[model samples]
Target: MDLIACHDCDLLYHQPSIAEGRKLRCPRCGAVLLQHRHDCVERCLMLVLAALILFTVANAYPLLSLDLQGREQDTLLITGVIELYRQNQAGLAVLVLCVSILLPLIKLLSQLYVLLPLYFGWRGWRLPVAMRIVDILHPWAMMEVYMLGILVAIVKLASLASIVPDAALYAFAALIMVMAATDASLEPHDIWERLSKTR
Candidate 1:
């Protein structure tokens, strides 16, 4: 038996073995204390793999191309960060670099590291540390916010230049959706249970 505390009401309850797809709720506040997701590790692994591919594509290709005055320029995802740094906005550049690129990449890779080993029935040293890193970096991954800012900039620049959306733009959009799905399918409680059994 496992003792679980309700995040909402702080009531502690003994967690029972629940059937797959079922949830244990807190008696006082009715907050879900534990949930059993069927094949959560497998599902999350696949989603993380897809997200990795999308992340690669998003960074490799040009996000959009600008055609202004018969001159065309293609902008990669890192262009803005580089430009910001060049303009002496080092702090903002570092912030964007970490939140939009580095943090998300690290989070995805950490998820992969944790899920892949668990899926293969192997125990890795410091697996919990990897999961902890993922949890910490979760809020710092702000690709969606960056994408929204891109959209706003595109809308504003549409009159000044002919903006053509490119492969990276689509890849970035897909990445956001896939990352969201990965987060939803990932059950931390299930992961913790699996980790506890590892040698």
Candidate 2:
């Protein structure tokens, strides 16, 4: 893959080979600029480690504290789901649990599923199915969505009570950042390159 840029203007283009479908260019400048990253697997692994740590913190502690009507209350991530479940919104509660809890775990696990084998240079087994699962799970891991939900709840409840953000909320935010970093750092071309070397 050739990364071409205009000498006269700051335009980038992804000069593709015959096999790479089609060439691409910078839309704004039309200078053939396309974004790409190098050493994606290595960078993604680093981000994954950070995300794992943040995920642990998010799940292990209270997300927020509230004082209302002369009473104190704190809610963990699971607690919110439980509260929803108790309110008879079983489906919504389950969806929350799935998105908040299960999806992150699946994303982490699926990443490991690919990373570990690739790291160890294992090419004996088929990974296409596992890759598909990773693709499906990536969109479902909604740390940012959960963070927005928490923020909205805090804003809506602030008029009625005193609220304090907790460490877990910060951790959740960090997890979102880490996930974004993983996506930005990981290059599909690098992964394919590694696979080609393995073959």
What are the lDDT figures for the candidates, one per model?
0.94, 0.75
Residue 121 CA error for candidate 2 (Å)?
A: 3.0
Alpha-carbon TM-score of each model against the true structure:
0.97, 0.78
Candidate 1, superposed: residue stretches over 4 Å from native: none
Cα TM-score of candidate 2: 0.78
Highest lDDT: give the candidate number. Answer: 1
In the order shown, what is each candidate's alpha-carbon RMSD?
0.9, 6.1
CA deviation > 4 Å runs, candidate 2: 1-37, 122-126
Write model 1 residue lDDT over 1-199, tens digit each, in one string.
7788889988877877889899888889997777898699999999999999999999999999999999999999999999999999999999999999999999999999999899999978799999999999988999999999999999999999999999999999999999999988888999998999885
Specify the poorest-scoring 10-residue window by lDDT in model 1: 9-18
* Per-structure clash totals for the candidates: 0, 6
Error of 2 at 38 (Å): 4.0
Per-residue lDDT over 1-199 for candidate 2, one digit per residue giving the tens place of the 0 to 100 score: 7775664476666755432333355555555333344445666777787888888999999889899998999889899889899999999998999888898878876676666667767873556555567678878877678788888999999999999889998998888888887866655555655666766
Clashing pairs in 2: 12-32, 12-33, 13-32, 13-33, 25-32, 26-33
